[model samples]
Every structure is written in C-alpha cells, then in structure tokens.
Target: MLRKLPLLVGAAFLLTAGPAFAHVGAGPVDTFSHGFMHPLSGIDHVLAMVAVGLFAVNLGGAAIWLVPSAFVGTMMFGGALGYYGWPLPMVEAAIGASVVVMSLAIAFGVRLPTIAAMALVGLFALFHGHAHGTEGMGLGVSFLPYAAGFVGATALLHIAGIALGLGLDRLGNMPATILKRCAGTAGAIAGVSILAGWLAT
Candidate 1:
C-alpha cells in the first residue's frame, strides 16, 4: 500500500479526467437514488472535490476538517439559494471559475490567511452545491442520499489528497516549490478546460 501510494494518487487525474465531463448536471435519473450518483458523473466535480482534501492535508490541524466542513456547510447554503431561485448571475461561469482558481491554490501553494481561505473555499462550494441541486432537482433522487453521496464521495477524495500529501512529505522531503508547480499547472489546465466548457455550453 505504501509503495503504490504515489501511483494511486498520480492516477487520480487520469481516472478522474476520463468521462469526467460525461455528466455535468443530472442528465437523467428515475429515482432519488440517481442524485447521489450525479457528482461522480463529472470529472470537474471529482477533481474539485479531491482538491479540497489535498489542500486540507497541506494546511493540517483544524484545517483538515475545517476546510471540508466549510465546504459542506456552505454548499448546503448554495443549494438553498438554488432551490429558492435566488438569481445568482453567471452561475455556470462561477462554478467553472471556482474549479480553476482552487486548483491554482494547490498548484502554487498560494499562502492565504486561514479565515480568508475558508471563506474563499466556502464561496466556491456554494456554486458546487447549487449546481448539484439544480441538476438533480425533481429527478426522483432522494435529497438525503444524494447529498450524502456527494459529500461522502467528496470527503473520500479529500482523504486521498491528504494521504498522497503525507506520502510526499515522507518520500524525499520534496520541495514545496515543486509541489506548487505541479498544482499550479494542473489548476491552469483545469481552468482552461472549464473555460472551454463554459464557452461550449
């Protein structure tokens, strides 16, 4: 398990990238059960979800939970906003931008005040949650189970990010510089992809 850790983490992008965009919003779902599965249908959601965990590992301490917590809490808020038709402008673009920006955070190891970081991430989660709600709406997907699946899967991804991050700490005392570069590059690419998606959509 230890030796293969790197390969496993590295493969996240490859596995996630495939058929990731295959489903942005819930295309179809007869039962409420499908709502729970919608988040996994897209790569952007998967990567964004995982990035939260990877970043938490980097931040450590209360952050491990705080960050993800903020995401969950705020996501619910976003969902509520959507449910009520709050009228947020440029919602799709915002969602894509969140993915791009957050990816850059990990890629560059951008140092931000903890409070600021949480707020930034939480804001992004709102867009995420809103999308989830909108996509799964009236799809027969159980709200509870759907939220659970989305949150649970996202948490699992975060754990993977933490594990990989810990592995990096042990492997070679890898330079922060290097990690930032990789993260930044990945983020840039994600951002571009998201931008393309927005344009196409």
Candidate 2:
C-alpha cells in the first residue's frame, strides 16, 4: 500500500507539471479555459488539493468537510477579486508555496493548529481563485458555472487524496509518519520546480 502511494502520487506529478507551467502568463480565455480545468490543470494544484484530502482523511470526522469548505470559500473570495480586476500581490508565488508547503504538511506530519491549517489552505485558494477569475476576462464563461467547475475539480482531487488515505487504513493503523514523509518529499521536489520556474520568469 505504501509503495503504491508513491507511484500514484508520481503519476499525478507527471500529469500536472506541464499544464501548470502553461497556466502562467496566459490571456483571459487561456486563463479561463485552463483555470476552468485548473485544479486538475497542473501539478501544483493537484498536490495542494490532494494534500487537503490527505490531511482530512488523516484527521478524520469534521475535518473532512471543514478543510475542503475553507478551501472553496476562500477560493471563491479570491476568484471574485480577480473577476473584478483586483490586484493581488505575489499571486504565483503564493500558489507555488501552497503546493510545496501543503504537500510537506502531509508528507512530514507538520500538523498545525486547526485554525492555522485553515488559514494556510485559504491563502493558497486565493491565488487559485485569482488565476481562475482573470483567466477568462470575466466574460469567457458564466462566472457561476465556471466557479462550479473549479470547485468540483478541487473536490475531486480531495476525494482522490481521501481514497489514498483510506487505502492506508488497511495497513492496520500503520504510523502516518511514513505517509507524511512521502508527502513532504514530494512537496520539496515540487517546490523546487516552482521556484526554478519563478526564477526563470
């Protein structure tokens, strides 16, 4: 099961990396078109969304809903800002950081106070929303449906993480330390990639 986790995660990496890079510097339609698919659009989004899922599954109970809800709520707020042509500082940096940091949280068991976790995830969602909002120039698609698509995709990734976490359950309460470690390592690698890209640009 543990071995499978790495492979599953790696597959996610292969799938997301290219699309994510394309997302940077795109026009409204490009942003909107891809942003509509953004949660699954790139590796960074995938890792962050999956991290939320893993954290909830590991936390159990209310956390399952709480974490995801916070993400969606904050994400929507961020989207509104972008749709309205608001300027946000460090948007890409924040998005990349969310991926690297959250993945590490899952991988390394770097549990934060529940409030902290919510706040952290919320921050990430802002950039995500911003990217989505500005992508289509506020006219490429109907805002409600477009927003719905992003939220749905985010939820799907969360579910995938939950599925992976549940699969870990079969290992008979094996220490989550291992899973955390795996998540952290992946986060680090992803973070480096994001940083490198940011630097180049």
Q: Please give the RMSD to the true structure for each candidate, in Å.
A: 8.9, 7.7
**Residue 97 lDDT, candidate 1, scale 0-100:** 62
Off by over 4 Å in 1: 1-25, 29-33, 136-141, 175-180, 198-201
lDDT of each: 0.62, 0.67
The candidate that wins on lDDT is 2
Worst 10 residues of 2 by lDDT: 12-21
Measured against the true structure, the TM-scores of the candidates, in listed sequence, are: 0.75, 0.76
TM-score of 1: 0.75
Predicted candidate 1 versus true structure: per-residue lDDT over 1-201, tens digit per residue? 224323423342333332223323545433434655566666666667667766776677778778877887898888767655565645555566666666666775665556766887787788777766665555443455666666666666667766766666665546754775586577657655765653222
lDDT of 2: 0.67
Per TM-score, the best of the predicted structures is 2
Q: Give stretches of model 2 more than 4 Å off.
A: 1-36, 140-143, 198-201
Task: Write one digit per residue (lDDT tens) for candidate 2, span 80-137.
Answer: 8888889886676667667666666676565555675677678778888887676545
- After the best TM-score superposition of candidate 2, give how far the Cα of residue 136 lies from its true spot, in angstroms: 2.9
